[model samples]
Target: MQTRSKTSSLLSAKAAAAASPATTPRPPLKPKPFLQLNKHATTPLPIQEMNWRMERLTPPPPAAAVAKVALARNSPDAPKVEASPLERRRPAAATVRSKQELPKNPPVNWEYVYDEIKLFRRMNSAPVDTLGCGILASPTLPPKVFRFQTFTALLLSSQTKDPANAAAIERLKTQLPGGLTIESVLEVDVKTLQSLLRGVSFHMKKAVYLKGAAQILVDQFDSDVPKEANEILKLPGIGPKMAHLAMQFCWGINDSGIGVDTHFHRIANKLGWVHTKEYDHEATRKELQQWLPVKYWAEINPLFVGFGQVHCTADHPLCHKCPVSDMCPKKDFKPRK
Candidate 1:
């Protein structure tokens, strides 16, 4: 009975101990750190070893993602969206383009040019004088002048600008029918001369001068325009420049006397060919004559003049689409509203 009681007491004690609250012990675990991705990487993820315990605890992904995987596994004909072309992508470090190189024409000073060509101005300009001067200088002079017709052109050019210049010469050929000769011009009186020169500037003065010039040509130069620059310069009202122009365009004088004009000097200085203090029509003529080769000599006046007249003027130049804009050294000339 005592042994039985003792055993029964031990069993009751064990049962009571089981029913009571008790402490539970746990194992120690180490914490791990994560990794960071860089800007160059297309996809960023930390590399990890998936333990069975951790993987089993995680839930499955969405059904749509699962469907995508299944489709990739099954059908090879699905629409393939290609990424960017390999050549188009850079290696994340190269800053400049590798293929296309820039043009390296001599730099023009565009700042002053822009300022001069701006719309607003304080100076008063006569339209006829300004535009007429440009027109006179605009025509491209041929390198070699060889014919009487050429000399005739120079003779007819007094006080006449473009369309009128061309018209007067053509009309004289028809009306007088002596091919711009001194005799033919002398035959036409003041009235006829005025009528012929009606479209030109200062017709009265020009008519008198034209008659005198023609008479002088007949009496002095033997109906042939003087080929010598000195002789042409000595004639009435024919200055160094006019002589130079006539010699260049009528008698083929190439290596001497660059006929400088307002357009030439204006455009050159504006483009920073020379300082304003050091620049003038004569100086610009000398500098450009030195710098620009003879091959481009004939082209300079016409191109710059036409461009000056139309796009780049004393006021208001259209510089936005200029071909040489990229090559300009000083490009900080912003157009005003």
Candidate 2:
């Protein structure tokens, strides 16, 4: 009975242990590696394992040591590294040159130069004196027609030599039905206008501009060219130079501004009458207007243009023959012997 009773108690204890929660500890799970290696590795060891071995073999320098080295390298006492030849030859950033300040008083004797130029122009007749845009139109045309013809001539004169510009004007005068009038320009097709302007530069484009300008004139200015500079500029292909010239030739008004073409721009700079860093005609015009007398404004264009055409030419100027050669500074000019 005692043995049976002990066996029964053992059985009861086993049942109780089975019903309770488990007490045995489980083994820890392995953590995933931070880096992954490719399966296509040819080395005996995985790439990640090789990296780990290298890291263990040579540890990084201490943070304090790194800071000290950086400080020493950046110190003023440290020697600078010499640049290589290519590095030394590298172009530096480009700097913009500012506009030059013009002198308060004339740099040279402008009046003397002016008189010499007038005398030189009178002695030698230039293409501008005869075939220029201002005189190209026939005097027989009515006042309004004459004005329109003068404006047309100026438009045709852009980037074209006086002879070619004159030829184109003659073609328009003869070929067009109404003789270069605003109505004739409107009536003629663009192809016909382009053909008439064959010798002129950018003839096709100028032809288009002519047609457009004529249409605008009919719509706005009572079929006549605008008298004011601002209104004249409203037309296509007309700039300040053309506008000022038109005002002078058409309306006999010269106080608007100087008609600064390439010749005028070049002569003014060479004479030291105006100081400009570049070939900026507008800047030259403004500088000339500031100091030049108003009475000479009307005559300067023709005088300088003729002078440039005859003596002070673009290439190999005849400085020996120049009237004011002794007084001239001859800026940026090497005269012919």
- lDDT, candidate 1, equals 0.50
* Per-prediction TM-score to the true structure, in the order listed: 0.50, 0.68
**Model 1: CA > 4 A from native:** 1-149, 155-160, 177-179, 276-280, 326-337
* Model 2 misplaced stretches (Cα beyond 4 Å): 1-102, 335-337
171-205 per-residue lDDT for model 1 (tens digits): 66567755455667788778887787667666667
- Candidate 1's TM-score reads 0.50
- Model 2, residue 207: what's the lDDT? 97
Judging by TM-score against the true structure, name the best candidate: 2
